[model samples]
Target: MITGLRYLNHSDALFTGKVPHQLGSLTNLQYLDLSWHYNRPPYRNVDNIDWLSNLSSLQYLDMSGINLTKVDIFNAITKLSSLSVLHLSNCNLKSIPVVLPYVNLTYLSTIDISENDVSSMIPNWLLGMHNLVSYNGISTDISKLIRDLSGCARYSLQRLKFHNNLLHGKLPDGLAMFSNLTELHAYNNFLSGCIPESIGSLSSSLMYLYLANNRLEDPIPEAVGELSELVVLDLSFNPLGGLISNSHFAKMTKLEAIFLSSSSVTVNMSSDWTPHFQLKNIRMGSCVLGPEFPTWLKAQRNKCLMQAFQLLYLTGFGTYLLKLST
Candidate 1:
């Protein structure tokens, strides 16, 4: 009969031992956070979380850093149809649940399962989450994960990060299907293939894009110029080649930082072409920027005013102002 409870957070407290099963009595609980701030000894881990199945009204649950290595986590949380946010990062989970399509997860929006032992291909049910907005699945095989995302809820997705994973194969053209996506972070993986031209489809909303340390090749797509809202872009340490001129950055008026180091690409902007945006940091190590110091940089001296420049082996590039004007 007790159904009025709402908030509960035991995070960072030095509480020890298994979570009490009696907590299931809070049938009306909406938010529950029993996450430990730091890792506890194996013997002190919560032996089970099956009690969570009884919290049918639960909307948010965070059990991060609480060792659930042996628990059947999916079975415990799948019934939480009201859940909107779930955080289980660093929980030592060995695998993600293979939820059936019949399961209800319509209201789920954010899911953070980073720093776990999830080695299998991402479950299919995850891609069908129509309301999903942000997803963080580091160190997993993300090749299939990206492909499946194109099936449904593509419009609701915003931030998608799968850094340091076993992701291989080309950056799928299907990624452009996510019109609402703002941040795309898939760095430090085995991903290969050229940056797809369809990426221009996200020109209206995308802001942060990080595809560094991969095996990507071919010329930078000229369609990138359509992304006028881009603030940060990193394509460094890949095998990308060909000339990247001012046309590629023509409409990126919001660009603040750029990294293009250790690649075969060349930045060949016209000497007098004035950039529309003001960049705070620019890294172009091992990149060919000049036969003559491009006069365009001189425009930055008066307008954008660089704060940090990491240029190596460039004959004409030199330091400028220490900070950008506000």
Candidate 2:
């Protein structure tokens, strides 16, 4: 008859043993977080979360850092019709549940199952979760995953992260469908090919974009300038080529940080071109930064002081760029 349990957060509590089955008695519980042991394996492992089904009113559940490799996690949680947010990140899961088409998780707003060992293609049922807003499924085949996401959850997906995965192939053109998308992080993957020009379609809502440490090649897309709301743009450590002049960043007036280090990009711009944006951090090491010191650095002195700068190759002229203001 216990109906008033509402919140429980035992994250990092260092408690050992299995999750108590008695918790299922708290039918009114709304939020429960038992995250533990991130650097190492969790001390506790649950064979089944079948007890969770009894908590019909559960809206938020986070079992991150717990071992659920042997459990059918999806089947257990799908029964919680009121669930709005679910976080099972860093769990030792081997695969995503095969969801049936008839099953509907329409109320789920966010799902983070990142850092797992999931090796299967994203289940089709996931796409039916039309209310999904944010998803982080890191360490998977990027191309197939993005393709599936673009096809299924394009309209409702806003924040997507699949960093440090086995992602390859060009950035999909279908990404342009996410008009409501605000942030995208696919860094540290094996993604290659040019940045798709279709990404400009998200200019109105997109803010943060990171695709660093990939095999992406070709010139920076001119459409990138259309992202007027961009705050941080990192395309560093890639084989990106072609001239990246002021025109490429003409409309990125809100840009705060730009990272393009260790790339084959050439920054060909006028020495006196005063940029509209004031940057806080700019890393363009091993890049071609012109025959003369970039005059835009002077304009950033008063409005935004350069916090960090690392220039590995400043053209063959061997002349140090403009002295940055403290």
Candidate 3:
């Protein structure tokens, strides 16, 4: 009556060949983990996961780094009605089943399918899972993914990470619907267009927002300063150009890290205006923050990163280890 089974704890121990079919016989197993070390090798192959249908009580399943190339993954897990969390990252999944007859996984909340070969739009049933709280890594149409998630899990979803997916599209205004979102990571994609002004609607809840290394070319919305709870804000390496003023950070009292390097954006705050939050790290390389060096830099007693030209403006700024970017 083993209720939990966790494998791959010892790095030297490698389970080769197929996943033990006997695992499905653990009818009372609530948790089963057979994730392998991704950096080593993926040898635990599962040509057929139909065996999983026997574990009706399975609530948590992690088969990451396993070769699931021959299995219809979505169809294999649909019957696990009690499933709450599922991790199948880097499983070499070749295709994703787009439609399911019905989804019995009413309690399913978190799923990570990152680093897979499934280059398709997210399945409708996956988005329709109202109880889903966090989703990570999947290649999909950015616009449709946002629209579907906003339509289905608007209030339930909290964390979303889909960076480095080569996704192209504007972040739709529909993103503003996820009021409960605390972290949104969509960096390193091919995304274009301006960040929607409606994103300010998540002011009370969003804590981490990363959108760096994209092709966005518009000025950041002044409404972004409305993110009162935001702890980190990154909008670097884009072609964005705009005059950023104090009003753009009027309510971000919780922000601790800000990254805007390699952008055309300019910071034009008043000489005497003090930031509401003290940053631990601030990067502004290739940005325009000059003329008379704003006195606000004196209060930011942390590591400062900027271009070599801006260093000439620093006279009496104390406690700043300047890291000049070439």
Candidate 4:
């Protein structure tokens, strides 16, 4: 089984009694997916580590739905230095292993340790990744967590997800260092403070930004409006006041960008901050616009006729404000 054997997916298959300790003999395996790719439960070998040591060539490990909460699993798994991807979603974990150190994962890419009990400060070991991507599925202290991952700037990751947790505190300045980030998902947390202004320097490659369901206050920085190619931006269910005055989406035109599929959008604010551009169908709710909605959306020009109208509206508003000052 060590010569030509490749993958072993026993998700739905029954291994009976205990997790087979003999299957770990495959030393040349590269990708080992045990997550029921199409919804399959793995071999019922819940938490047996006797044979996993034989997987020296194992790079990608998917042990989801295994009910493996050994806590010491990573201590043994870290022996596989070639590991790149590790998915442990929905595992019955109460917290991340702090006593263990994952020094061997130098080339690791993504990590999904979600649906567990990691309800505290993220381990500093996570910052060791030089090429880490996604760090989703955490359900504990977050303010300090973001601060810890700030040290992992050498990798320039693209995705960071930490939603549905009781995370409180201000967003960190470390995010500015993630210039290469493409998506950041931190919804359903207890976060507060204004959205950082440094986000203006983020890479244009960013396609998704989910910051809904938090206590983030203040205005949505105008810098966000600069993301000319931004597609999905959700910041719903937050108590962000003074942010309604400016629609941070003022510069997206799509430049002949065509959409061939349906899309989903989430908003957590109390206002409709749409830029005066096009008429793409949108679902806006829970917005704090109260009963009187903003006029920027209705004034946007589909062609060019309404362009003058929008400008005229802005000009009139400015003039009225100037008159009040005089």
Candidate 5:
């Protein structure tokens, strides 16, 4: 009898029938992962997870892709005071409990409830997770979620993934509050309006910013250049206008990939102005690049994706004449 066992990983098993409740006897278990895939599963189902409360010492749990429709999730895991990381993605969860009577896991930091149908507001208890750093809840009221997160996880939260959620409306202006935030992905949504100017405030840490395939309009804010650590910037498929000046890339020294394809913005930089970053992939199709192709591109000798720059005006359909030095 391994009563002292502290870690168990039974992920991706084709186990059928009900989830074994006897696992609760492992009171000292600090890590458990019974997650499986939705397509390859014989499908393990858990009608109730009341026994999870017994694993008071549990620090990490990942039950993603399990059938947990009948579980009282909020109440079952609330008492796990030592639990820190939880993943419940694609669990067939219908709703997130709007209110939790009490929250005991003060040290909990990372949680993923993505790909669920819990189309509700960000729960109050979730916003109160004082130490929460990484949250991946599925789309909800975008405005409300940002507002609440700005106040609660302002200093702690870092990565936010709300992409492909059909989220609408403008990104609220208070984003600067997440001082520690590094990656922000809200692409493939229905978000409109200009990127907020306050985004410059994350200059110290912000790295990857993806807002592609949205209806966002207006000029790309110069504040975006303030993200000194930024690597990938994708704003493709939007109807953005105005001159894309050299100031936009003045401080993006670490930038590698940039996608501006199908956008309406004109590259109005001085012909002699060289970019600060060495871009590897550049997609500027259908954008106004030049009467004479910008000579600065010659500086990116290591760029490998020059074919992606099928500047329609300069090179007629499929004519990739200028190649990087490699």
Candidate 6:
């Protein structure tokens, strides 16, 4: 008799059975996930809690792929004080569970417990979360997640995702006080430094900024071309070098996408740098695009209105392909 389960983790079954012994009458359950869908049915069920203390109107508590061990899931998620959103990505979580502020859920925002075996500090009681916008997975202290997101700047965050893991150092000095941060996904990790000339104070309705790969070297400054309503800018690979030009993004014109493959592998474009390499989703493969590369991809389809592209592996461009697909 599974009673009234509002939400049972591991994606609703596939190694799911326990925690169903009449689910303690559900008590008008709000949301309770036992966790497992590390991407669906990843299989993680050993001695289930069987009824989860008869959940008392749970808010949203994903057990986060429970392998248990961290004192048996933070002592049963601190007795679930109406949890809001807590998915500890991979189990094996090391720290950061200080009873989570007696979790009244208080309308919690988002918290993904990334990869696992967490470490690197960053549990300042989640800055007393006043409806946090995001507390992206795992630890590995990237300066304590920028000092708990610079005090979570009044928590009006728009978007934030800490991609990959192993976040090392650099790029976290108050992060412009989250002036209503739009999006900042710290890719890969092992973060070296650079790319923070106050990052232009971001938030011009900022749209996606990922520091790809890591070990960030020099060049990528120019205050990120003044982020004019920037839209998707991933600094590929790292080892940053010169000519990190943007010429002020040719007035940005609401740039769609632009990822400089090898920041500086040989790329020496100088036809007056041509209107600041106008973009509509470009990956700039191997740099050095001197030759008649379709006259610079038909001059980026003569400026805008281009649609969808990937343009992978460049270099003396062969096995050609550049179908702007209308």
TM-score of each: 0.84, 0.88, 0.87, 0.72, 0.90, 0.31
Instruction: List, residue by residue over 222-314, the lDDT tens digit for candidate 4.
Output: 787676666766665666544334446656544222121111222223254555446433333423332222455444334321111222333
Q: What C-alpha lDDT, on a 0 to 100 scale, does residue 289 get in candidate 5?
A: 76
Q: Local error of candidate 2 at 75, Å?
A: 1.0
Q: Clash pairs of candidate 6?
A: 9-34, 114-137, 267-288
lDDT (Cα, tens digit) per residue for candidate 1, span 37-124: 6644532366767788899999999988877976777767789999999998888888886666356778999999888887656677
Expressed as tens digits, the lDDT of each residue in 1-326 for candidate 3 is 35354322322256688887777767877777888865765367887787899989888888888888877778889999999999988888877777898679899999998888886578777877898899896865887788778777899999988997988988888888888999999999998999999989999999999999999987889999999999999998889998889888989898888888889888888887999888877778777876555677666655545343564665643224433211
Which is the leading candidate under TM-score?
Answer: 5
Clashes of each: 0, 1, 0, 12, 0, 3
lDDT of 2 at 195: 94
Question: On lDDT, who's better, 4 or 5?
Answer: 5
Question: Where does candidate 5 clash, by residue pair?
Answer: none
Clashing pairs in 1: none
Roughly what TM-score does model 1 have, to 2 decimal places? 0.84
Residue 115 of model 1 has an lDDT of 81
Relative to the true structure, candidate 4 has a C-alpha RMSD (angstroms) of: 9.3
Per-residue CA lDDT of model 5 for 97-201, tens digit only, reads: 878887887988999998898875788788778898898887646888788887778999999888878888998887788999999988889999999999999
Candidate 2 per-residue lDDT, tens place, 131-220, comes to 889988754555577677777677888999888777777788878878899999999888888999988888898999999999989878
The whole-model lDDT of each prediction reads 0.79, 0.79, 0.81, 0.62, 0.84, 0.62
Please give, for residues 1-326, the per-residue lDDT of candidate 6 as tens digits: 35555665444455653434455577667776767655555456435553555675677777667665424555555566677677767766566655453544456677777777766565656566667776676656666666665665344665667778767878775676777677888888888878777877673756678888888887666676677777788888887776644353534556677776765634444444544345666776665454444344444543343222223333423333334433
Worst 10 residues of 6 by lDDT: 305-314
Off by over 4 Å in 3: 1-13, 137-140, 291-293, 302-309, 318-326
User: Which segments of model 6 are wrong by more than 4 Å?
Assistant: 1-15, 21-33, 38-60, 63-81, 86-105, 111-132, 135-155, 158-178, 182-223, 227-232, 235-258, 261-286, 289-326
TM-score of 3: 0.87
**Reference-based lDDT, residue 190, model 3:** 91
